[model samples]
Target chain A: MNFIDFIQAITEYDFLQKALVTSVMVGIICGVIGCFIILRGMSLMGDAISHAVLPGVAISYLLGINFFIGAVATGLLTALGIGFVSQNSRIKNDTAIGILFTSAFALGIILISFLRSSSDLYHILFGNVLAVRPSDMWMTLVIGIIVLGAIYLFYKELLVTSFDPTMAAAYGLSTRLVHYLLMTMLTLVTVASLQTVGIILVVAMLITPAATAYLLTNRLSRMIFLSAGFGTLSSIIGLYFSFTYNLSSGASIVLVATALFALVFIFSPRHGLLRKWKSPKKELTT
Target chain B: MYAVEVEGLSVSYFETTALEQLSARFTMGQLVGIIGPNGAGKSTFIKAIMGLIPSEATTITLLGLSAKEARTRVAYVPQRSTIDWDFPIRVLDAVLIGCYPKLGLFKRPRKQHRQLAMSCLERVGMQDYANRQIGELSGGQQQRVFLARALAQEAELLLLDEPFVGVDAGSERVIIDLLRTLRDEGKTIVVVHHDLSKAADYFDTLLLLNRRMIAVGSPADVLHAKTIEGAYGNPLAFLQKVEVSS
Candidate 1:
């Protein structure tokens, strides 16, 4: 179908409308939280939490409860496990992340093998955005609002702790509490994006758009807005491509986001490779 | 009342003793420089007192209050290397973080907070660079930004870790002058310094540390040969250097 037909198709089908709304909501929330994750050098931690939610999803399926509660529980468990292992022993943080996420992911695969509804597992691994229900869309919207609201409420605390925890503590703010709060927000955002991006591709939604905005902006607030803009735009474009070519929705979205990152990486005014190449003397001065 | 009082502050990392049974006291309005050799626990001492590191102290009080309660009235400028300068933030936003604790959890900074941050920036001569990206600054300028943030805290006690390291002469002079002004205004300042020769001239009091309190007194009394030898064994070389410089 052509562009006009695609637009018409979206309006005609409720499933398409739900898919479009869910993707945009997922993009905006992921983009917002991803800025903090990348700034705090927790990109690997984000990857670990996203992958680690698999076991929770499987358990939630077996127990017949909401997947979000299970996923959030497992995500928090992974975060705490990584923290405990790294903090209590000689093991570094990245090493702890690697150990926990791999094991958790492996356990999830094993758990899924024992389940009767294994076909449902396939959709969870690789998202089927077109099959998203209206209820799922509402859930995503509610979770998105909660995550964004928490970030807004704790913006200063998060900023101070991430920048300099020492100063944060000296100022009477609990740095540890802020750390856990951030991890909790990350968990919520990860769970919210699971249906739209799947387990494996959610980290891209969290990192790529924010990283792209990081290249273009000098302020965190600006980076957040720009990141959300890029995320929403990517979701729209990727959803269009998916509808037109029958592509995997999650992969298409990630690819579009990555392409945007590449464009900014080479063309951003102050930090871009192309800008440096154009003015070597100015680069040296900076 | 003394600005700081500690009976026995001990800290250990893994199996290594960082600071052992350190005891010291300082009066208010003193610019105290903590000078010690490498691995001598200068940073550890500051971090321990600030409760940044795990430590066991019998009695550690600041401004006659418990350490935890007194922290609200304290400002800390950590070492330059502890921060990620490439993280996307403006100079003004970074300084505005000082008001976060005052604003508590939900309340955002108002116009008055921004004006205070701007005034702090002006004190450090960083007002011109307030709109610039933090990563775009030089090392000295970045240090100044950190100092500006501490100034914005408006605390009664200030702890600075290696504020002069890698700083340009102009920035160094500006920082020293600002610190002295703060001291003159009845704010207690403690600086972690490395240069022994300049320590005598920079601080009104000297804290010679080597995993313990070697000496705590006027610069003239603490910079003597015996105390230098005690803190840093066989201190003939350092003593002669200090003697010649003085």
Candidate 2:
């Protein structure tokens, strides 16, 4: 379809509208939290939490409750488990993350095998943005507000804690509490993103846009805003590609985001590889 | 009242003792230096007193208040290496972190707080660099930013860990002068120092430590050959000879 045809389809179809709104909301929230995730060097942790929520999703399907509630509960448990194991043992944090996420993902696979409605399971693994219901859109909206509001309210605490936990603690802020709060926020963002990109691709949403912005900006606030803008732009563009080419929505979305990141990686004026290669004389002059 | 006091404080890592049972007190308005050989628990000692690390102590107080209660009134500058200098924050924003404890949760830094942070940067001679990204600054400038953050805390007591390691000479001189000024303003300053040569001139009181309190007194009294030998072992016999000669 041409651009005019796509715009007509968006207005004519309710499912497309819902998908677009849901994808954009997911992008904005993920971009905002992804800044903290990348800055704290917790990109892998974001991946781990996203994957570890699978068992909770399957279990919630069995119990006839909202998958989001189950996913968040299990996400928090996974975070606490990783924290506990890493803190108590000689094994490092990355090792602990590796062990816990794999075990949880395996458990999810086992549970999913027993479910009668396996079609929903497939959608959970590879997102079906076109299948997003109006209720799911509302859930995503509410969660997006909560995550954004929490970040706004505790910006300074999170900043100090992430930047220098030693100083944060010395100033009487509870570093452990701040850490767990961040974990909880990550869980919320992951669960909210489940329908947009599914578990497998959610981590891309959490890291790519933020990292792209990181390469372009020198300030965290600006990085967050730029990441959100990139995320929203990628989602809108990805939706167009999916609609026109009859492609999988989540994959297209992630691919566009990744492509944007690659573009920025090669061409960002301040930190780009190309710029650095071309500006050898600038360094000498400075 | 003493600026800091501790009784029978001890810290241990897994399968290794970091600091043995130790007792010491530091009076207000004094510039104290904690000097020890590598792995002598100099950093560990300050961390424990600040409650950054878990430890057992019979009694610990700051200005007659419990350590936990007085923590907000204290400022600490960790080693430069411990911070992620590449973080995407301007120097001004970093300095404003010192006011976080006061603002607590839910409140943003107001105009007054910004002015206070800028003033602290001015005091550190970094006001011109406030808008610059932290990673763009030199090592000494980064140290000055940390100092500016500590000053913005407006604390009565300051604890610094290895403030001079890998720093340029100009930064070193600036830091020492700043500490002396803070001291004259009646704030207690404790520095974890390694350079024995400068220790005599830098600190009014010397705390010679080696997993335990070896000595604590005025520089003239504690810089003795016997105390130096006790804290640093025979590897520094040259220091003892130098002390006797001087």
Candidate 1 regions exceeding 4 Å error are A281-286, B237-246
lDDT of 2 by residue, B223-242 (tens): 87788889877656537645
> Judged by lDDT, which candidate is best?
2
* Candidate 2 Cα misplacement greater than 4 A, ranges: A280-286, B235-246
Please provide, for model 2 over A35-144, each residue's C-alpha lDDT reduced to its tens digit, 9 standing for 90 to 100.
99999999999999988889998899899998888888888899899999999999999999999988998898889879746787777877888889999999999999
Candidate 1 lDDT, A74-113, residue by residue in tens: 9889999999999999999999999999999999889888
Write one digit per residue (lDDT tens) for candidate 1, span B1-246. Answer: 778888899999999999999999889999999998889999998888877778999988888888788877888999988888788889998999887767787999999999999999999999999999887887789999999888888889999999998888888999999999999999999999988888878999999999988999999999877888998786674666678856
Deviation from native of the Cα of residue B150 in model 2, angstroms: 0.8
- Measured against the true two-chain complex, the DockQ scores of the candidates, in the order shown, are 0.65, 0.59
